[model samples]
Target: MSAIGGPCDRALWYGFRWASPKRFDAATLKRFADGHQTEAVAIARLKACDQLEVYDLSPDTGRQFGFEDHHGHFRGHMDGVILGLLQAPKTWHVLEIKAVSDAKFRELEKAVEKVGEKLALREWSETYYAQAVLYMDYADLDRHYCVVCTPGCRRWMAVRTERDKPEAGRLRGRAQTIIASDSPPPRISEAPDYYQCRWCDHAPVCHQGEQALSHCRTCLHSTPVEGGEWHCARWARKISVEEQREGCPAHLYIPGLVPGEQVDAGPDWVEYRLPDGSVWRDGGAAYTIGDTIEAEAYRHAA
Candidate 1:
């Protein structure tokens, strides 16, 4: 099985339990990393502006602000906070920076122009709106300044937003539901060939159900500590929430973890017969075994 990352794995925004868990292929991961690098440059330029006093919160070891829910299960990290801007003076605002493609930037710009910033953000990008609201609520700020930029362009757009208590509360409830449940939430569709599922990184495991015991928190070897800490018996050490969420290569599912009849068993692998007559394989790296069927079929036809 693929290694899990950290507590952020189970974040509501990542849509792991609600949608499918994100599995980043090399190209996708590279693109994500490149976006962050570009955003870093943009932030540096923003900091250089004498009119603004930017407080950087992205650093791992710094004066960063975060929030943990009552159970300490949900966590969020703010990007930064800004003190002054030409539009909003003498007021502190949560700073959210996003680097989008030229096309996406144009879309956002047009939406803002046509329907206004608040309505356009809700209609165009619910994710961004939710993120901004969550940060605003956690940082105890009423106003937010979102900075959107393009990769190769110095031009940027700034949109201001107010605190959205209702939306933030809804998101908090959704996060709690994900953390409390053992079974995953229902898929967006029942069909395997659904468009979103086809492109999802977690498609392979999501469709397989219990066969993919990849989450460390779900593994029997992991035990919860007092403050949402996870201890892995296999590793014999306390693992951070992120480490627990991102399971290790040595992960092993507890016996009878999957609720199905065992059809075949081997030293390192077991196949179970599901109610739908589909076979679910549980073992080391077995989750990826049948993932290349389409590619193989294409090769044979060619």
Candidate 2:
């Protein structure tokens, strides 16, 4: 219900609808609740910081700064009530909180595109960084903070650049002008493989017959690297279906810990649910719950 700036949620919601209407069943509400819980956790964390102000920039600004990409511009709306806005001397900071899953992150990443265009697909976090960079440009702020809180873990980071950086400032201006225009821009006859019709919400009408998953075929670096692994690229692949499922890895079942206890279960590869609602298969470790399941150990315990 709350609107956050990132396109991760909208991309996931649309993916759910496309994958199967059932994706928005009971689990959806739980996800929403979990999101709020994450926000609360993030707020608490922000309070711990020495200098941070969690306030509403929407009302005072009088204009919503959307993510210039396809989903942010046309399909998605930003979420969360700006956790906090930092101001000092003449500098400003925008704090955006996210309670999103790894898969949603992927969709949001792939959804980035030119201003006022149809949605596409990309990695979620990268897209988030792009959007945040855009926000920095919009607010004319120097640095931005992202506080991401999952069910059992909380992570916060301050992304700063010595300067505005060329693309960051220019993209924001172009997007703002495009958004304020009265008429919408024309559509592309065909999108890139990654931004094809299958995953696109407009796909139903566009009927481009493009498959939703695996847009790498059209990518310039499509060559396969056998036994090739890159440490940096691994982060993007971390959110795959096999790594984020309900009873998958990563999420360890801590016995006796209450739902609100702040416990770090360490890092493990968990199963992830894909955009098409299909659970990724992982032949890795598994986690099980015992009779000691409690609600007090998680970051938020009600």
Candidate 3:
């Protein structure tokens, strides 16, 4: 949901394809933990309110509100749903909870003064605005309620967002188009130092012509199929997420990602000429980069 409506399609494409394994520093991991804690506090506070009926978890499923589409490729779990608000007693509204910095909270306050909270959301963070819009679209609601809390969950503010069907429809099309693509879309910027590219995780592969991490999703043989599943042409089977993460011996690099000249190829195998005239091959019992002793031995064979 967040990636689909982002400004950079190519970055989103790389991420969807598992171009690199997601990594986080300890600080980032701590922040994520803090966010979960904040969400719990917000839920508790919302429940304490007399006028608002907040359902953080589903009575039937015993799980948070979740929505999926596009063969399960596109999905998100909402913070909850709110009803019986003082303003709209009968209508349901999608609920999103986020923890921002005090500075960001103040910025939101100023934004509300200038443009009102709903429209001010775009100025706050396009990613959150996208999530709110998509959540409303999926939950069959006309409005979304975003609760922004400070880092320590000490303060919070609420913003109301209305549904934009035109924008939702546009995002849906964009998501499908991105999913159906066999290649990355045009980059938001071509230069490596461009603001967006510089900070991107996929920059190594996208701009430096480096190889993407070896995974079924990054291989040429793999294709996303129905049922939120992935199919490998070489294996001709629906692969699980675990299997996708640990690709097999016959993995073939998508040619565009090879960073070399193709001189020869065969079924289950591809050969490339390196810049220094070294020859490299992958697949069909070739120099696979998989985590194995053989791969380690042949790491510099090219």
lDDT for 23 in candidate 3 is 92
> Comparing 2 and 3 by TM-score, which wins?
3
Cα lDDT tens digits for candidate 3, 163-226: 9878888888888888878877888997899998898998898888788989888888899888
lDDT of 2 by residue, 1-302 (tens): 12123233323323321221223578889988888787767667666766554453356565444433422432233332333344233455556677777665444444433311112211234456655555665555666555555563443332332224575655444444433332222334345344533454534422342323322211111222223211112122322222222112123221111112232332332344444555543222442332223311321221
lDDT of 1 by residue, 1-302 (tens): 00111122322222433233445689878767767877788779889999988887645568666777746667766678888787778889988778787888888989898989757765556777777788888878998887888864366887888899997887777776666555545666667687766665555555545244366765656655557566677556777656656665445454334557778866446678877889876664533333556424422331
lDDT of each: 0.65, 0.39, 0.82
Screening candidate 3 with a backbone cut-off below 3 angstroms (N, C-alpha, C), the clashing residue pairs are none
Please give the ranking of all candidate structures by TM-score, highest first, separated by commas. Answer: 3, 1, 2
Ranked candidates, highest lDDT first:
3, 1, 2
Give the best candidate by lDDT.
3
Candidate 1's C-alpha lDDT?
A: 0.65
Runs in model 3 deviating more than 4 A are: 260-264, 272-280, 284-302
Query: What TM-score against the true fold does each predicted structure earn?
Result: 0.69, 0.39, 0.89
Model 2 off-target regions past 4 Å? Answer: 1-26, 50-92, 102-126, 152-165, 168-196, 208-302
Cα error of candidate 1 at position 149, Å:
0.9
